[model samples]
Target: MWVTSSTATALLPTAIALGNFDGIHRGHQEVVRSIVGVDATGSEDCSIRRTVVTFNPHPREFFSGQRRQLLTPQEEKVRLLEALGIEQLVLLPFDRELATLSPQDFVEKILVRQLQAKRIGVGKDFHFGYQRQGTAEDLRAIAQNHDIEVKIVSLQACGRDRVSSSLIRQSLQEGDIPQANRLLGRPYQLAGTVVTGQQLGRTIGFPTANLQLPDNKFLPRYGVYSVRVVLEKTALLGVMNIGCRPTVNAEAKPTVEVHLLDWSGDLYEQTLTVNLEEFLRPEQKFSSLDALKAQIQTDCKRAKDLLNSQL
Candidate 1:
């Protein structure tokens, strides 16, 4: 999909899907699919673009003192939407002005004037406008005046629980990789550039490529994960550690280190995208180097078995 900022001028009529789309989980995907589906099943309108209108800094980040962690961040979010066949992405800035626009103004200015949307889609719980006063029904009522078709997608669920970004975050925080993956419709991933480390892993005979996760990136429970690593054109099975390495040094902060099985090469300054397939154990302090090395060997074996079974 082609990405355009909010300030860019819009010329084509669009079938737009609107939301923060934090994780772009199953529910978000369903909503997006509906937009693509509409374009597919409706009349051949060459001017109608399949577009996604998402926000930056997220809405919650503006209203609260605490910063919220993101599942897909901005770059990854774009990649995911593009993969879903969206034709256009309009990343609107979320500021005081946008936060205070009335429901009517939002519809008139964004949906009508800026996007020229012929049809729009969102999840059932979507709210917009000043003080979050608008509802799906309100959106429907307002957009109709501009001859816009509305699609309010139903809530998706995982068994009894609703499928939502918050729920997925909770799963990731709790290190429930399988649950998070189930809700996300895919494995939860962290993409970052591989940076140089202390090279302590080399002494332990398990040299690692250290990753520099993006700012405010959401991390699962601190420990070990059985992961799939994407290194340039090759995919490799790997065991990743997300911890401070207490067995080595107590003064250090947490870091992500990956030991790729059956592969060896210089990876510094390269991008490495790690998909957390399963959580193995929590980070803990060990008494001796031998104990840590023995445990790491066990972890590697367990990770290999888990990763191999999936293949």
Candidate 2:
């Protein structure tokens, strides 16, 4: 039900929500949830398709730097939007050709010519077009000319601050896991493929699944954490370390090591999601392997208590 610009020749008469939807945070959800037509109530629409329009390469990253860490990759975005009742996902490439579109051109080319959208839901602060000249007001004015309707949703707030991906990223960078989790409406998670490790954990009676995070994925503060491990069909309780293994004299390159308390499977080369529930402490270099193993045991106990309470 999801297609990029290259594959999209035609689409259904959809009611569309437009934005990057990075992190798919609370504020972004408000825009998607507002597409319930003039009556405004249901999360899903049975009469017509509900679609999401987001840009590939994120406009911010396209204009700025490729080194920017993405909150949710395109694959992850598809899953989250699908759960929120979006039937179609449209990805517009954010290259120079798209960047040159004027406000009027954008309204005609994509919103009308391609989508033929029944309704459009956007944030009050949403902007588009060449040089970022278009505003929500501009969109509404143009929509009236085309006999289309637009809904502008107000921003959602977390405590005194507005909920935003930037704010969430900042919280994670600072290692404020609880604050980040609260804003996300879920735990902050990172996904990576399990790779071979030096077998140091097994030598100490604790075996671990080592993960090398993808290059473009954002990482939180380098430290130890209480986490939830997501396998293919089930979740497990775990403790994780996010850093180079200083005690073992490993390389300076950072890696993730997860020790699932109740899991004994062979996870090599398998992709897994590690959800950071709470920050346990900064990664420390124990003077001895015995000390490191003992501290890990302590961390396991702490993680089990926290996870059991969640259950």
Candidate 3:
């Protein structure tokens, strides 16, 4: 996908779709599909370019001090959009100035004048402009005046609930990997670097690689999980414990300690991507070191059995 920072010079006379597209969930997919469908029927090669306009730093973060964790990183979002056949991505930097633009100014300057968009697609619930005064009706009026066509994609539903990033996050937090994957159309995974620890796992018979998660990244609830760890090109089945080490009375931050089955390596500083496959048990404080070690053994056995069944 071609990525452009400046929206002024980036957009050609294109058919543009607009949204935050945080998770790029199924609902967002419908909007993009509509744009592509329109593009496919157009006769001129460059008469209409297909593009997506999204913001950086997430507009919510500016208003609210805390922001919901993102499901896909910026790079990952770009890659997924490319796979969906999006021709260009206009990444506008969100700041105070952009936030204060009037609804009419935003449409005239960015959408109509700069982009020269002949067609536009957006979700039914999408909002924009300072204080979000821009609505679907407002967009329709603007489009009508400019002779641009506007398409509104309805929300996509999975089962009874509508598919959304918030629902996906709640499912993951509840250890419902299956439900999360169902909405995401793939397993939820986290990427982190392997950092050095105090070697406590070594003393207890299971050596672990300590993981450092990215800042602002959301983690699943603290628990022991059956997971698949990808290191370099190989995928390894493992049991991962995510929590503070309560038995040792360590006041450390939450870490993902993974024990790779039948694997041994010097993985310090290397990055590992872990996919939580199933929730085995919640994190608990054991009374003694021996008791904690015993529970780990049981967890490992269960993880191995679950992985075996899948193979």
Candidate 4:
């Protein structure tokens, strides 16, 4: 999907799906699918684009004056949306001026005038305008005045619990990888560039790739995990440690280190995406290097067996 900033010229008349879409979880997927399905029915009108409208800097981050932890950062979100068949993405800069717009003005000016949206899709709980004063019903009422159609999708659930970004974040923070994956309809992933580390792993027979993640990326519980590493077109089973390495340097900062099973290469500066498949264990400080090495060997075996079992 192609992306554009808010200031970009108005797009062709579009059917827009709107939300923060932080995780692009099952619920978000339903919203996007609803709009895409609508667009498909009007296939003859090539001028009507399938668009997704979201905010940059996430409104919560802007208000907090801090970088909020993100479930899926901008690049990942774009990839997920593109996979859902969205043709356009519009990122509106959430500044003070935009925040102050009233409900009527927001719909008339931003959606109708700027985005040229002919139809709008949002979740049932969606809110917009200054101080989040507008509800989904208000959106429908306002958009109707401008001759625009609106679709408000109900909440999606897995078992009894609703599928939402906040719930998914809680599951990750709690190291409930299975629950998180179920809600997301896929394994929760972390993508970043591999950077140089202390070279401590190789000294003990397990070489690892140290991942440097984005500041705003939400980190799961600090623990050992069984993961799948994506390197270009290859997927390798791996054991990942997310911790401060208390066995080596107790004062060290938290870091992500992945030891890919049956893989070896110079991976410095290469980007890699790791999908968390299972939570192995919490970080622990070993009494000695040999003890830590032994435990890692066990961890590697466990990871291999678990990953291979899925096949």
Candidate 5:
């Protein structure tokens, strides 16, 4: 999708799908699918542009002190939406003024005037306007007056549970990778820059590249996982450990340390994206450094076996 900031004036009039779309999970996918499906059947005169309207700084972060965990970063979210055949992505900056717009003003100014949306798709629970005064019903009424088409997609459910970003976060926190993947339609991945660490891994004969995760990104449970690491655009098999170094009595800040199979290089400051393939084991406090080293050896063997099996 063509990603553009709101300040960019030279954008096409388009049909917009509105939401935070944090995970762009199955529910969001359904909305996008409806837009594309409608666009396909319309005549040339009815040709509508497909776009996504999303906010930065996430409204939750601004309205509340809670540091909401995100399933995807802005860049990655745009990339995934583009892959799904969206024509454009409108990134609206969330500030005090924009946040406080009334329901009518938001519709008239943004949806009708700025975006020129011929049709808008939103979930049933979507709320906007000052203090979330606008509801799906309010949007429909506004759309009717403005000659805009409104589609309210019902909530999507997976098994007995509703598919949502918060639910996905819960799954990750509990180390339920398989269940999280089902909700996300893909494996959970983390992206960050590789940074220097204490070099303790090297001393234990298992050198690792420590990564600095992005702010607001949800981290998986602190444990070792069979993972696929992408460095400099190449994918490698690895075992990743996410937790404090309890065996060494280190401070409790969470860290992601990856040991790439048969790989050696200066990866400091380089970005690496790690995709968790399977939950290997939970983080444990080993009796000694030797015990930790021995466990790592076993972990590496299991990781290698997993990779080979996949191949």
Candidate 6:
């Protein structure tokens, strides 16, 4: 149900949740739910398709001509949206022409004429069209001309702070895993392909799975973490390290490697998703491989204790 086109004619009348839903966090979920509802029936009268309209190449990325590290990349976002019962996702290409569309034109031409949007939902702070001049209120006033309903959902907050993608990113960057997970309404996850590594862990009787992530996947703080590894629907406990193997080679780039506790198998080329549960310690360089091995043993023990306590 991922329709990656700017011009594909929608077959059914649509109720849309519109935004660059980067994280699909609580606040984004609110906007989506406002339109799709809990059952995802869309609207009462018509058989409306539940659609989410998001820009491709994200406006920031388009403008900067650079890929931004993402909380939820396209594939993950599509999967998450489908789980929320969305029927279709329209990825509009963000380019110079789309950027120059006036607010009225954006609503009338894009939402009304093209998508046949009967209802649209957006966050209160949502902006669109012509140098980002369109506000939520503007959308409401303009959509009214086309007899379209616009729901501007209020900002969602967690305690004193607002629930936002940037706030969650900051929490992750600081290695505040609990805070980030709390805001996200789930654990912060990184999914990657299991690749071959230097086999240093194997030599020490602890084989690890090295993850190959997307070039623009956003990483949390580079540290040792208590984590849960999901493979083929089975969850396993593990100790994950997200940093350069400084003791082995200080000049190496940061890498994500995990040693699953009480689990052993060939995981080469298979996909695994790691959910960071707790940050145990910062990455530190040790004098020798033996010293690093000893620290890893402690890390695995602590990770096991933390994961078991949760269960």
In order, what lDDT does every prediction score? 0.88, 0.84, 0.84, 0.90, 0.85, 0.89
Q: What's the residue-level lDDT of 18 in candidate 4? A: 92
Give a tens-digit lDDT track for model 2, residues 115-157.
8777889998999999999999999899878877889999888
Best by lDDT: 4
Ranking by lDDT: 4, 6, 1, 5, 2, 3
Q: Which of the two candidates, 4 or 5, achieves a greater lDDT against the reference?
A: 4
lDDT tens string, model 5, 1-311?
56777735625667778888999899888877766646423644234667888887789987895677789887678778988878788878888999999999999998898888788889888999999999988998998898888888999888998999899999998998878888988778888888889989999899999998877677889999999888877989999999887887766688889999989888999998888888899999999899999999999999899878977
- Give the CA lDDT, 0 to 100, for residue 31 in model 4: 87
Which 10-residue span in candidate 2 carries the lowest summed lDDT?
36-45
Q: Comparing 3 and 4 by TM-score, which wins?
A: 4
The 10-residue segment of model 1 with minimum total lDDT is 37-46
Candidate 3 residues 74-155, lDDT tens each? 7668877888878899988888999999878888888898888888899998888999999977887887788887888888
RMSD of each: 1.7, 2.5, 2.7, 1.6, 2.7, 2.0
TM-score of candidate 2 on Cα atoms, chains taken together: 0.91
**What TM-scores do the predictions have?**
0.95, 0.91, 0.87, 0.95, 0.88, 0.95
| Model 5 spans > 4 angstroms off | 7-10, 37-49, 305-311
Per-residue alpha-carbon lDDT of candidate 6 for residues 1-311, written as tens digits (9 for 90 to 100): 74656557655678899999998999999998888753223436447888999998899999998888999987788888998878888989899999999999999899998888888999999999999999999999999888888889999988888999999999999999999988888898989999988988899888999999977788999999999999999999999999988787654578999999999999999999999999999989998888888999999999999999999
Q: What TM-score should be assigned to candidate 5?
A: 0.88
Candidate 6's displacement at residue 275, Å, is 1.0
C-alpha lDDT (0 to 100) for residue 181 of candidate 6: 88
Native RMSD of candidate 4 (Å): 1.6
Candidate 6: residue 290 lDDT (0-100): 86
Query: What is candidate 1's lDDT per residue for 35-150, written digit by digit as tens?
Result: 87455347666668888998876889878957888888878988999899787888888889999999999999878887878889999999999998999999999998877889
lDDT of 4 by residue, 1-311 (tens): 77888536546788889989999999999889877855534544567888899998799988999878899988888899999988888899999988999988989888888778878899999999999999999999988888787989999999999999999999999999999999999999999999999989999999999999987789999999999999988999999999899999865568999999999888999999999999999999899999999999999999999999998
